[model samples]
Target chain A: MAELTYIEAINSALREELARDRGVYVIGEDVALGGPFGATKGLAAEFGERRVVNTPISEGAIMGLATGAAAMGLRPVIEVMFVDFITLAMDQLVNHAAKLHYMSGGQLGIPLTVRVQQGAAGNGGAQHSQSLEAWFIHVPGLKVVMPSNPADAKGLLTAAIRDDSPVICIEHRALYWTRGEVPDGEHTIPIGRAALRRPGKDVTLVATSRMVEVALEVAGTLANEGIEVEVIDPRSLLPLDLDTITASLRKTGRLVIAHEAVEGAGFGAELLAQVQEAAFDYLDAPIARVGAPFAPVPASPVLEQAFVPGAERLAGAVRKVVLGA
Target chain B: MTSELNQQEAMELLRTMLLIRRFEEGLIQTQKSGISIGHFHVYIGQECTGAAAIALLEPQDKIATTHRNHGHLLARGADPRRLYAEILGKAAGYNKGKGGTLHATVAGLGFLSTSALVGGAVPLAVGAGFAAKQLGERCVSVGFFGDGVLEEGVFFESLNMASLWKLPVVFMCENNSAGALGQSAGEYPGSTIATKQLIDVVAPFGVPASAVDGGDPRAVRDVTQQALARARNGGGPTFIEARTVRWPGSRPLWPELSTGETDVAFAWEPDRIPMAHRDWFANDGLIRYVRQLFDAKLANTKEILALDATVRADLAKAMRFAIEAPYPDPASALDDVFA
Candidate 1:
């Protein structure tokens, strides 16, 4: 095993999948030219232009191409430059790819993977900064994945490439440089299984994306105050591991969900609802949620910080829900 | 090359056009009966467009279309019953009742898929064409849309990309004079960029194009056959504009549609439909002589409807299954989202 950054792990997994399957290929704007984030650097040099295609600046065309290719028995890994721009291709993702198999009486299989970078980190601002995973999670027949760590990112992405459906794997711009030990050789992670990073009995803290880091930080701080909080990173939001979350809630009788998206209808709220519906009898307090306010993520660093949930706000929510203060 | 299609083939083509026309009329009546609910745009006068286009396609070729899709869906061999069930919102419908009237899909028949959004299906068809090219398959992806959708940027971008890559696709524009609310006058800058201008726009892209009379199946078939044969033989994309008129009042119009007082023959009504629609429907001198054509088409349609009954019953069974089917275990609502 070697320590790799989230971006490196994702690129490595993409490379491995491409090498492993002849049917697999990558397409997007600047994907052949090393991409906007350079995640696809040196890929075009190795795979040639046909495999690592550089397309015109048309998001809809790229996604629609991926869907059509998937329908035609090709495994296409499409990279949307920024998650914000994915809105422009929403028709392809929602109307075509996601609904193809179900609509085609199971005669068609859409083995397509869409990689997108989302969320606020370096003031990419209102347009560039968005956690639109919740939007895809709302649709049926789509797999919505956002990994909080390098290994999970690589593993989940590899799994997404092989899955026989449309999978949206979101990479955070903030998590790209964060390093972890990803399996050196070929590895695949099962989607829908939430990882229990730190187990405890006092309260269950569920988080996703960059917010998972905040929950882990808050777990440590709360531990010093004699509060044992379990931090659960829901690697995939759509096909969520409800059984594990419900079990955690059953053990702790308390739940605090967090994410970088707005509180109104973020994945956190969806997680909370699942736990509440399944383990409502075990609840000792109202579920606490830490999320950004419902507004366009601001451009200013300070305002962006205030707009999204951080370790401080997350810790406070845990304290309030756990210590009853 | 004219010998490629025999007398039987020609009759089959005419029969298919009649089926599409009758099926569309059925959908309109189904909508009228309140069984199907939604804003439906039926191709009442454009049956030849679908018949002729599909006649040019092979089994491996794929197709995509816009919201006004009942005719194309049926023309591509989709069962009228499951399609009817799809419109009925029954569980056993084509898309398991998920995609209603606007979004119908049949992968087995090579229809690939359809979408409700304008200009939505164009890029997908381009992508399918790209896939066909990549696989070294002798196939073409055909996309059908109205003149109103031509204004969309995705359509232009698709045209540019397909040519840039030399992908095999036929961009069939059914310029039926009027779109849902906009008239051809309001939709276009002027007749300067008429169907011929559309062909000219794609000429420089190295993609050969032409505009044909959409109401006449022979014209549509002749133009599409030349285009599809060229595409399969590795010639790049081709854009064909089928210049047809949607029977007036078939769809609601905006900025006020011309009243029927001046042109009663051009008006669309329930009883004054189908067989008599050509001469009686239009201001033509061949009104008395059209009886033979109408009688022949009527006999063929009656036979086709009889064959359609079994499929309709099967679809009805599927509909019963969907309606009586148990709802998702409220908990399973979140089941498929992640996995």
Candidate 2:
């Protein structure tokens, strides 16, 4: 095992997948130049331009090309510069890529992986910083994944490239610089499974993507106060590992769900509804949710800082759920 | 210039156009008789464009088409029985009744896929060419769309990328001067274009463009051959705009009235339709091609009648097979939704 940042781990995964399968290739805007965030740095030099392709600034055409290439026996890993731009390609992704295999009556398979970077950072403003994982989670025939750490980023991406269906991997901009220990080679994490970050008996804190780190920090602070908090990171959102969350909830009756997206119509609402349905009788208190207010991400530093939920907000919610305030 | 055709080639072209014309007529007759249901776009006047363009492509070459795709699929050699069954939503259809008339796709016959959305198949053909080039395959891919597709941004993007990458693809635009609602697309309220010639739109991308008479099968076949040859020789993508007209009977058939707004006077007598609108019938591409065949003496009156009889008998058998085919089991609806 070696310590690597989230972006480095992602690059490692791409290199390994390109070397392992000749049918695998990368295509997107500026992907050959390592993209805007440097996640794909030096890939073109290693794999050559044929494998690591650069495309024009056309999201619809990029998605269409990837879907067609995937249907014609190539495994393509396409990247949209930002998650917000996915709206431009929604028709191709939702209509063509998601429905082709089923519409063709089992005659075609779209083994394409679309990577999108979300969450607010660097004061990138409203158009560039919105978290749109909820849109993909509601779509059937699509696997939605959000990796919380460097290890999960590498392993989940490798698994997505190998799967025989369409998958969307949402990577947070804030998590790119975060470092963690990742396996040396050939590491793949199974989709639809949640990872337990911490164990506690007082309450369960369910987090996703960058929120996992905040939840862990809250757990550390609560540990000094003799209040235990268990953190569960749901790696895959669509085929959610609800059993793991329910098991943790069984141990700790109180629950607090945290995410970076808006509180209205966010993925947190779905988790809250499902948790209540599964473990209604076991809950000692009503579930709590921590998310951004119903507003677009701001451009100013102060406004952006206030807009994002942090460890302090999560800790406050955890205390309220535990103390019945 | 139109390509020169020998006797055998001229006969085959006429035969292909006749097959498409008769097949669409059979569909209208069956629908009027209450044997089939669901809406479909008929390629009545535009049959020559697809028949001749697809004739230039090999069986292994791929082509993606729009909603008006029955003619293109038939021209690419799809089985008549399976295609008819597909329109009937039968278990024996090309997509096993899962995809109806709008989304029929048979990969074995070189049909990559069909989209109900206008201009949706343009980039898909470019992608097929990109894949073939990466895999070192010697086949070219083609896309068939209408004049309305020119306004879509994806079409322009596809042309630019195909030219930049030097991918072998042919963009065939069938300009029938009408949109889906039977209105002149050029005169539509929101339609605005700077160039009167469709070929000029792609000239800025450095791709060779041409226009031919879509009413003549020989003209379409010759132009498509030159485009395909250029693609095969590593000369990159080419754009061809075929100017044609939609027949008056191309709309949905209504047999209740003898002479209504959407009704044809001689529904059964496709051969005797007048050659001009002044004679109460529009000039059709299939009729023009058939006349050329007779004038050239490539097919005598006896041979033309014999071919028509064979096509009618084959279509009758296909309609019977479709009527008898079983419906898909309801429990299997959830199947094939994923790989």
Candidate 3:
């Protein structure tokens, strides 16, 4: 194991994948320069320009090129800089990449992994700070993953690169610098499994991505208040580990789902529906949700702080569900 | 630079063009007879561009084409039986009834994929070329698009990156002065600037660009050869705009939706050309190619007629196979969504 930040873990995963497979390469805007953040820094120096390709500021072309390269027997890891900009490449990602294997009658496979950082941080306004995991999880052919810490980040990225399907890895911008212990070499987490960070009996706090960190903090505070909270991080959103969440809900008899995206139509809603269906009668209270309000992320520090959900917001939701408010 | 073709190569080119023409004709006839459903775009008048450009591609090379892709697929040696089955939405089709006329792909034949969206395939070709470069392969990738594709932002982005990386790709624009949904090129806004010549738009990218007579298969073949050679030799991409006419008979799926006029029309009778307007079928690529074959004594009329008969018979057998093929099982619809 090695102590690394979330960004360092991602960089390590890229380096290991690049060294592991000849077909694996990285391509995206400013990727050679380590992208806007430093998640891809120093990769080009080690791999050379041919493998660590830097593309123009064209999301559509970047996505289309990656899709084609994947279909033509290459494993391409594409970075979109930010999650919001993925909208520009939706045609290629949603229409072409997602549908190629199905549309081609299983004659082709697109082993593509698109990496994009989301979550509001550093006053990065509406455009750059939005969380769009729900948009990708809704697509049928896509595999959506969000890692809460440096460990899962490395493991999930490795798994995504090895999978023979199109996987979208959503990394939270705020968590890039957060340090944690990650397995050193060839560590891979299965795409559809959930990780239980804490065990509790009163309520279950099901979270994703950055919100998982918030839930962990909230769980600690709740425990001091004598409200034992279970924290479950669903690493992969599409093939959700609903079984684990349901099992936790059965034990806790209450649920509070949390995410950084908007409350309405977010991944929280999908989890709410699934948990209710699986363990409907186990509820000790109406399920609570912690998410940003239905407004765009603002640029001002105060508004941005208020816009993003934090440990206090999640703790409040947990208190509401646990105390049956 | 002109790439000389032996008589056998020239004959093969003629055969490919004729085969595409006949294949499209067969599809039209099948559609008319109510055997096929859904919309299809035929490469009727612009056969030479696809046939000739694809002829220059090596087996390992790849090509991504637009919705009007039957010609490119056939020219690249995709099986007619499978293509016909796909158009008919049969389980035996290339895409197992999932991709019909608008999205058929035979990956084994080096025809990577086809896109119903205009200019969608351009960036894909760049990706394929990038893969080739990374793998140290000498394969060159080609993207066949229409004149309307120039307006798409992705096309320009593709060109910029391809040139910037010196990727081995050839952007072949089959300019027929028309867009999708049967809109005239002149009718679209900024048509004057975009449609005048493609070289002007690509010149800013510092890539070699040229315009050629798309009607003559040999001319297209020579130009395509030069571009492919440059790409294979690590020279940057080349943009070739082949000027041609959209076949008058290439009507929309719904005849009523057609604008009652074609952007370019050809005269069926050669003798009437003198009195006809210069734009009235100024150059029929198919006829021109056939004339070259006869004039050069590469094939006599009897031989040419026999070749046409063979193509027709083969298409007839393909249609029979397609008609007899089974429909996909409803339960299988969910398969192949992911590998």
Candidate 4:
């Protein structure tokens, strides 16, 4: 294992996948030039211009192309640059790529992975900073995965490239520079399995994407306070690791879910509803959820940080669920 | 020489055209009889375009077509029994009733996706070409869409990328609109494109473009052959716009059998042809094909009638099979959501 930043881990995943499979290819607007965040840097040189393709700035068409290529047994990984711009390719991703397998009577397998980054930390304004993982999670045909750290950023993406179904791997912009040790080679984490970040007895905490790191921090602090908080990172959202989560809830008897997206009608709501159905009897206290407000992400760093849900809000929710305070 | 046809080729083309024409008409009749297929588009007037263009394609070549996709599939010899079953939403359908009339993809036959949304599958053809090129295969891919597809930005993007990357794909635009662009009597509703000529749209991308009389099977076949050759030779993508007058039976909304089930006798019986839909019959590609066969003596009127009878008989059995085909098990609806 080596210490690699989230962005470097992702780049490694692409390089490994491209090298591992002749059918695998990378396509996006600036993918030939390593894309906007440099996750695909030097890939074009390594894989040749054919495999690491740079496409025109037409998200709809580019997405359609990837979907078609995937249908023909080609594994295409597309970088949407930002999750916000994915709206332009919604038809291809949702209708074509997602539904093609079922619609074609199981004849086609869309082994396509769409990689997008979401977070409110960039102060890139409302258009660029919104965490839109909920929209993809709601889609029936798509497998949604969020990697909170460098290790998962590599593993989940590798699995997504190899999986038969279309997967949307939601990376966090803020986590790109965050460093963590990733396994050296051929590391693939199973999708739909939750990673246990910390084991505790007082309250169970489920966090997604960047919130996992935040939850770990809060759990660490709360541990010092003698209130043990369990942290579970649900790597995959669609095929949710409800089994691991309910087991955690069964042990702890209190739960709190956290994400960077808005609290209203977000992934938290879905997870909360599912958690209740599975572990309603086990819960000793009402579940708490910490998330951004309903407003669009602000451009100013002060307003953006204030608007985004962070450690303070998570700590309050954790304390509420664990201490009844 | 462009219109030259061998006896077997002419007979096969005529049979394919008749099968497509009869299948669509049979579907309309079924819908009218309260079977309720739900807002399906037909390749009524432009049968020749599909039959001719697709006939040139090898088994390895991929097809991604639009809403008017029945003809393209039928042209490639897709069983009418299964196709009918698919349209009727039955278990024996091409997609096992999952994809109905709108998205009838036959993956086994190299069809990628039959998208109902306009221009949705246009870029898919290019992607198939990209796959072929990357895999070092000499295969070609084809996209069959309508004139309205030109209005979509994806079409332009597809053309630009296909040209830039030298992807081997044929973009076949079936422009059924009559007169200039659109908005004339008996004209098919089409895109209000800024370019006077559809071929001119591709000039900026530097992809070669051509126009063929869609009614003429020979012309459609010839143009498609040229385009396919250009693509396979790594000469890049070729765009062909097949133009046809909107069939009179093809109405403003729901199509009608206004022409009363295309009589092959119209080929010889000029006086028997109705004057009201005269232009439709006169320009009818299938009918013109029959007339050309008679002139060339590829198949006499007697032989042609016999072929039509056989096609109808086959279709009759296919239709019955579709009608009798059961709906898939309700529990299976949850299946194939992934993979």
Interface RMSD (Å), every candidate: 2.8, 1.1, 0.8, 0.9
Q: What's the lDDT of the predicted structure labeled candidate 2?
A: 0.85
Ten-residue stretch with the least lDDT total in model 4 chain B: B178-187
Scoring only the second chain, what is candidate 2's TM-score? 0.89
lDDT tens readout by residue for model 1, A20-77: 9988889999999888777888889988888998888888878888888788888999
Q: Which stretches of candidate 2 lie over 4 Å from their true place?
A: A276-284, B1-8, B184-192, B251-271, B274-282
Ranking by DockQ: 3, 4, 2, 1
Q: How would you class the docking of model 1?
A: acceptable
* Candidate number with the higher lDDT (1 or 4): 4
> For residues B67-139, could you state the per-residue lDDT of candidate 3 as single tens digits?
8888988988888999999988889999999989888999898766788887889988999988888888989
DockQ comparison, 1 vs 3, better candidate: 3
Question: Please, what is the whole-model Cα lDDT of each candidate in the order they appear?
Answer: 0.76, 0.85, 0.85, 0.89
RMSD of 3: 3.2
Model 1, which residues run further than 4 Å from truth? B1-5, B30-39, B89-100, B182-197, B200-206, B253-280, B283-339
**Model 1 fnat value:** 0.51
Tell me which residue pairs clash in candidate 1: A238-B337, A238-B338, A239-B337, A239-B338, A239-B339
Question: How many pairs of residues in model 2 come into backbone collision?
Answer: 0
lDDT of 2 by residue, A3-72 (tens): 9999999999999999999999899999999998888899999989999999999999998888878878
